[model samples]
Target: MIYLDNAATTWPKPNQVTEAVAKSMKYYGANPGRSGHKMAIRTSEKVYECRELVADFFGLSNPANVVFTQNSTMALNFAIHGILKAGDHAICTVMDHNSVLRPLFAKSPDVDVSYLGADSEGVIDPSELEALIRPNTRLVAMTHVSNVCGTVTPVEDIAKVCRQHGILFLLDASQSAGIIDIDMQQMKIDLLAAPGHKALYGPMGTGLLCINTDFELAPIMQGGTGSYSKELTQPLELPDRLESGTLNLPGICGLAEGIRYINRIGIANIREHEAKLTAYLLDGLSRIKDINIIGKKNTLGRTGVVSFTHNSKDCVDISSYLSSNFSIATRSMYHCAYKAHEALGTSDGGTVRVSLGVFNTLSEIKILLYALKNMM
Candidate 1:
């Protein structure tokens, strides 16, 4: 099968990732940090190694600042709920996934929110953000890339505005974490969240939240953090402050191996390969008379995700045909960004999403194009 839905969750993860996860489950089944036994210590060390690797990959100064969660949604929830309080205002863009939008809306009824608009191509303007910023704006949460449209937001420019106003900047790097370069120090990002199942090539149930030491967020979950067993209150340290209960050691072990693989292969090389494949798909889809490609015409300002719609075919039908008849997997829907679809004028029916991964090749894209043409 030719899988093209890497944006949702990567498939055929790197062999190292699978091997590492299996090894952890089979060899070290002990709960990390719960005991001082050899097995427990070894498990704890592996988890810390994963944390350090994630910190290095994201250019974070300290590994302790990184907190592991179940997925990006959980990390986002922690950042949103922990940072904002009643009567505070936050700014976000329409291109954000529901993971970011829902929590902000669920804030105290007294809290205020501003949903900034994006262009037809799903690009958010820095000036638009500047105009929306208010004195009461405590945080500005936005995504690095639109999962539906594949449009890369101007994060650095937005970060500049947030820095100038002294507002907390929260970046949802769900789409761009492993593929794009993100520097926490340079971007002035106070909180960053991402899922390991996507570009990181890790197993599911692994996510990360990096909090800047200067900013303190309340703990969303409180329990025995292993550090403050005697105290009723949770520890106020970097990781133990947020990470409660036993972490997913097996998933984190795979995550560490995945980061190492990315480091060895180089992120730039992976970016180049995906960009070329996206460009090739765009060129091929553009040739079909009845097809309409979405987002930026070129792959310069986008990740490996490509979205398009055909004149006569329904989006769901196309995806079904691809999966059943052609054995080519694709995603068709709002992509969890209903507002983004409205902004891009695809509210009638969401576009077909073809997301390439590091393992994807030109040959797979060519086969997908041929399949699309045959369907047309």
Candidate 2:
């Protein structure tokens, strides 16, 4: 089966990732940082090793700044809820997923929230944010890439604006982690959150939040971090402050392997490969008389995600037909970016989303195009 719903979660994970997960469960199952036993020490070392790897991967210097979470949603929530106060104002884009929108919505009435509008092609301007910034603006939460349509955000430019205004920049890198080249320091990103499961090729339970700035974020959850056991209050240091309770050691091990896999292949190569496939898919879709490509109609400044709607067909119906008849998996509907769909005028029923992965090939895209044409 051709799996094209990678924006949701990547399938057919690399062999090393699965191997690492199983090996961790079998050999390194001890609770990390909780004890001084040899096994526990080994587990702790593995966890720290992953932390270092994540730091290096994102161009950060300190490994302790890396905080592990269940997924990107959790990481995003930790950033949103932990930073914004009652009187604080925050900024986000319409291209954000519900993960960002809902958390900010929960802070309504007390916190002032503003949404930066995107064009029909899902492009957002960094300059427009200046007008919306209030004196109390504390954070600017923006996605690195649109999950619904794969439109890349001008993060470096936005980061510059945020830095100039002393507003914290929170980047949701859920769809662009391993696929895009991100330098936290160079970009001046304050807080970056991403899932290890999607482009990172890790297990579903693995995610990470990388803190690059000195600004402190309050702990959303409190429990044992294997350190600071004497005090009832949470620790002041990073990672420990945000990450409470026993960690997901096995998943972290797998996530480390996933990053290793990306390093082995190089991010530029992965981006190039997916770009070719996305361009091919877009070109093919353009030839179909009834198809209307959504978002940026080309491959420039985007990931491998593409969404399109049929002039006469329901997006869900087309997705169902692909899965049933062609054994192809594709996502349909809002894709959790209702604001984006509203901007693109696809909110009525959304669009069929085709998200390519590192494993996808030209032939797979060819078959998908063929199936789409035949279905029409």
Candidate 3:
């Protein structure tokens, strides 16, 4: 099967990542940081190593500031709900996924939300953000890349605007992390969230949240943190303040291996490769008559995610046809971002999203192009 729904989750994780998860489950499956036994200590060390690797990969200085979660949605919830309080205003874009939009919606009326508009290409203007800043604007949450349109937002410029106003900057790197170059420290991002199952090539049920030391967010969950066990109140530490309950050790083990593999292969190579593939797909799709792409025609500042729709075909039906008849997997729908579809003028029926991954080859894309042509 040719899988092109990587925006949902990467297909066929690396062998090393699978091996690590299996090894952790079979060999060192003890609970990490919960006991004094050798097995527990070993598990603790492995988890710590993963934390350090993630911190370094993201240009964060302190590994303790990173907290593990189930997915980017959880991390985003913790960042959005935990940080904003009554009367606190926040800014987001229409291109934001439901993960960000829904959380912000839940806090509406109490926490004022200002949504910045994007053009037909789903690109947010950084200059417009400066005008939206208000005295009560405590945070500016932005997505590094739009999961719906594959448009890369100018996060660095947006972060600069947030820093100029002394407001915290939260980045939802759900679709950009590992595939895009993101420097947490240099970008002055106060809060960052990402899913390990996407470009990171990790197993599902793995996610991360990193907070800068100077910024403090209220604990979303409070319980045992394997530290300061005597006190009922949550520990006043970096990650312990955010992390609660038992960690996903097997998933994290795979995450660690995924990061290691990315490091070995080099992020620059991965980014360039994906960009090339996206450009190829864009070119091929544009040649087909009656097909309309939702975002930029070129892959100047985008990931491998390409969303398009045939004028006569329903996107859902087309996706089903690809899967059932051709064994080619593609995801179709609003992609949990109805706002994005509305902005792109495809709210009636969402576009077919063909998101590529590291394992995909040009040959697969060629097959997809021919299939799309025949369908047209």
Candidate 4:
């Protein structure tokens, strides 16, 4: 099957990723950091190695500042709920996934939130963010890339505004973790959250949240963290403060291996390969008269994700046809970003999303184009 839904969750992870997961479970399945046994220490080392790998990939200074979570949603929740308090104002763009939006909205009614609007292409202007920064705005949450439109937001520019205003900058890097070049130091990002399954090519149930040392947040969950056992309360440490219970050691091991694969291939090289496929798909889709491509026409302001709408065809119908008849897998519906669809004027009928991964080939893209052309 030609899988094109990497935006939702990547498929066919690298051989090393799968191998690493299997090896971890087979060799060292002990709960990491819970025991002094050799296997437990080895397992714990695997988890720490992943944290260090992720930290280096994102240019984080300290691996300890990185906390493991269930997924990007949980990471976002920890950041949103832990950082913003009642009566505090927060800023977020319409292009954010529900993971980022729902947690902020779930806050007490006393907490105020400003839903910043994005342009038709799902790009929010830095000046607009600058205008929305109130005296009480404690945090500015934004996605590194729009899952629906595939448009890359000006995160660094927005980060600059947040720095100037002394507001905490929270970046949802669910779409840009391994695919894009992100330097936390250069971006001045206070908190960055990402999923291991997507760009990192790790097993599911793995994620990372990198918190800057200067920024302090309350713990979202409290329990035995394998640290500060003498204290009745949760420790005021970086990762232990946020992470509780047994960690996903197997997944973390795979994530560390996946990151090593990325480092070997080089992010720039992977991005260029995916961009070539994206451009190829875009050119092919543009040739179809009935197709209306969404997001930036050029690859300059976007990732490998491409969304399009077809005339006289429902998105679900086309998606089903691609899956059943052509053996092509794609994503339809709101993609968990209902507000983003509404912003792009695709709320009535969500566009078909075709996202490329590092392993996706040009031949697969051609086959997809052939199927799309036949549909017309």
What is candidate 3's TM-score against the reference?
Answer: 0.99
lDDT of 2: 0.94
Give the runs in model 2 whose Cα sits over 4 Å from its true position: none
**Colliding residue pairs in candidate 4:** none
Candidate 2 residue pairs in backbone clash: none
Q: Please give the RMSD to the true structure for each candidate, in Å.
A: 0.9, 0.7, 0.9, 1.0
Candidate 4's TM-score: 0.98
**Where does model 1 exceed 4 Å of error?**
none
If ranked by lDDT, best first, what sequence of candidates would result? 2, 3, 1, 4
**Pick by TM-score: which candidate is best?**
2
lDDT of 1 by residue, 228-319 (tens): 68899889997998999989999999999888988899899999999999999999999977889989879878888889998898999999
Candidate 1 accuracy as TM-score = 0.98
In candidate 2, what are the lDDT values of residues 84-155, reduced to their tens digit? 999999999999999999999999988999999999989999889999998999999999899989999989
RMSD of 3: 0.9
Query: How far does residue 312 in candidate 3 sit from its true spot (Å)?
Result: 0.6
- Candidate 1: lDDT over CA atoms? 0.90
Which residue pairs in candidate 3 have backbone atoms (N, alpha carbon, C) closer than 3 angstroms, thus clashing? none
2 or 4, greater by lDDT: 2
Q: Rank the candidates by TM-score, best first.
A: 2, 3, 1, 4
- How does each model score on lDDT? 0.90, 0.94, 0.91, 0.89
